[model samples]
Target: MIPEPIPEPRDAESEAQPLDAYSQAVSAVARELTPRVASLRVRQRGREGSGSAVTFTADGFLLTNAHVVGGARGGQAAFADGTTTSFNVVGTDPLSDLAVVRADGDTPGPVTLGDSDGLVVGQLVVAVGNPLGLAGSVTAGVVSALGRSLPTRSGNAVRVIEDVIQTDAALNPGNSGGALADSRGHVVGINTAVAGIGLGLAVPINSTSRRIIGALMRDGRVRRAFLGLVANPVPVPAALRERLGQRDALRVADVVPASPAARAGLRRGDLVLTAGGVPVSQAQSLQRLMFAEAIGRPLQITVLRNGAMVDVIAEPTELDAEHA
Candidate 1:
């Protein structure tokens, strides 16, 4: 066989400019997701506010930030293609900063939701939303961190949103309630808050958030089980970890008087290792287990105390509005 001829390399002048890997990924996602984002015009208490929303269902349900709709009964959702229609608030969960709105007329079509739990730090992400009243704006960045906790207050009840997605994507006030998409164009998070320059947070679209969204759509509200306890993450000792198969645990910092934990004889300095027979390493895990369905139910919580394990039964109560 004849020897293969060497191919000549093309000159720089003759070669076409190529986009980088990140640019290509973002461009592809933006093209598929921009059309699904909606610019919200909310009028509440004689004041008009603007933000972004994403259609979460085919029958005209939209997901947005509760702060964006602030006391607004109805609003207009303007799509990128100029389709504007009136939408009424179905429910609002201020503790999670999520709200559901239903369009009076046509729907913008729902977006493909991704598993935020699968996201890793340094993963590429694209944000699509209406920022500062600009429709269909797109921004790209990498996930800066994970497992962030955001504090939210609804009336006198203060709660923490766990597993919040933190990114470096440039976000403005109007970007709240927008879609944070993965490389495959699936929405992994709902943009929620901006901390500082180059820092943004989104509510992860995990099982917990999905439950809240479903409750909002069906019951017009999310009713959660209240467990009056404040805890912080602490490392479990090697001996205790081997016994419980848990490396870290939540240390009880406070127990409200007459609360479920208090009534169950849980005290401060106790390290919580399991709830409802499942291992729990974060406060959010306990919160997730305390859904509305669990109200008035006996929950078995195992704790590590003084190098020993003890089990207690807590009767969770319905979370009232002022304390949810």
Candidate 2:
């Protein structure tokens, strides 16, 4: 047999290079956050169920989905370190699908909250939680969409969780109430729903949600003011933009009969430019202004009607089960 040609000297430069950037980022996040996630076993109607929760405070305050604990007051939280603690529901806001629970013992350090406002589509995100009762589970994906609305109802109160984060991470039923963290391990959203294969939804952790969390911790409920107007985002005309300084506005799609908007003389096709001196571009902007403090208060609404800017004073009514 012919002698094999002398193998060329192995070149180190030609060696396969490892691309571990993605892995490193995800692993770092998982390492930091896995400890703060908890597997919750809740008892409801004589049946035991499991869900995930994130410890948002060092003293054992946890944030979870209201639907997960649905009508239950107490549960057990198991952490990654095999420690378990009894937790009691502090409050629940079905409209936001968020609930706060206080655990009996110490917990891992609270996660740092990140601003969801800065999130962009295609940003890498990591989901950490207990899924299908598998505690400390982790998944990685990109934010596929943003500014989504999740409609919810509690009794007769119809509400929408606006600006929800949509990701491509695989979410299971137990993933509800878990953390949807960024590459830096900051919690940007709370995992809420599994829409379809590779599709997940989270409640964005922004100013509005921060307020909701504070309310749940303090008052055990969130008080909201209702303006009975169906609106859609629309661009302000060039002429209107120069006067209002806003490029986008909410166009009144339908004014509820005898409701606040109707009472205030708001009509169909009215382009809402501002509410209470704040720019009204999307529904969430108005929702942010409709806190407990705004209830029963005269809200100055500026709308473009027939090419003229008109101010309408509408007193918001407290949103209740009987009238949402």
Candidate 3:
């Protein structure tokens, strides 16, 4: 066999790079992602805040938080080129806090989607969007934590956001549903909830969002099942371990009537052990499963009660705009 060719050495043809390369890179990414953003000037039936949504799909499709575009009887989406177009709400999923809109004009393609499950804490991340009426804004920060739970503003007590990626990424109001991109310009998370303080919150585009996106592109609504229950993490405490028969699970506060849980016989004082065979109650794990689950697919749920194990089948229903 011919001797293997010697591997080429590292080329020193590198162009001049400045120390402010970090700032430069941020600007470059902002430019690349911003042309895709269109301001969501929603004209709601009721009083709703005006915000922005970024473009993710070509063919005039855009992505935004459900609350941002929800309940809008009429609206206009404004682009950076001073061109504004009328848009219609295509889909909304409060569980995932995402909505898609289709405008009457050409839409730029969204950033490349990436694997959110591979994100690491302390990794550098950047948020690009219009914040507080400021356009073409970008902020940088590290992944503060993963697997976070925040209550819904609806207070329906039926919904609790889990697996939220916490970042000090300096996000602001208009950033909702904008692209939280990785250094390589791949989309990782959808900027969703913010503390309304200095803290920023985003939902990782786990396999779940991907499916939702595909479905929304195909249909105007996402048909997924839901468990009519108010849930909170069952934190492992020294006292609860003995009194509650702890199992690193989610404690059920309330369950919906005539829901999959009620049909499958889920009751109070029960702890959810797993969702469709994956561990439940860990904010991240629960989120990952819900995100990946197909709407209407019966879920095999493992639960613990009085130190005994039980199972239930729960199917999610379609998420509709009128539900808001």
Best model per TM-score: 1
lDDT of 2 at 4: 88
Q: Candidate 2: which pairs clash? A: none
Q: Mind sharing the TM-score for model 3?
A: 0.73
Prediction 2 TM-score vs. true: 0.81
Q: How many pairs of residues collide in each model?
A: 0, 0, 9
Can you rank all candidates by lDDT, best first?
A: 2, 1, 3
Model 3 agreement with the true structure over 1-324: per-residue lDDT tens digits: 999999777655554466487777677777787777767778665565666777766677788777787667457777666667888888777777778888887666666777777888887778877643456767888788776655564444345555677888887777887778777667688788777566788877777677777777678666654555445566644655666455567777666665556777888767877788776656555554543344678888887788677877777554433322
Which candidate tops lDDT?
A: 2
| Cα-lDDT of candidate 3 | 0.70
Residue 168, model 1, lDDT: 92
lDDT of 1 at 313: 97
Give the TM-scores of the predictions, in the order they appear. 0.83, 0.81, 0.73
- Candidate 2 lDDT for residue 177: 92
What digit string (tens of lDDT, one per residue) describes model 2 on residues 9-38? Answer: 878878857649999899899999898999
lDDT of each: 0.84, 0.85, 0.70
Q: Which 10 consecutive residues of model 3 have the lowest summed lDDT?
A: 315-324
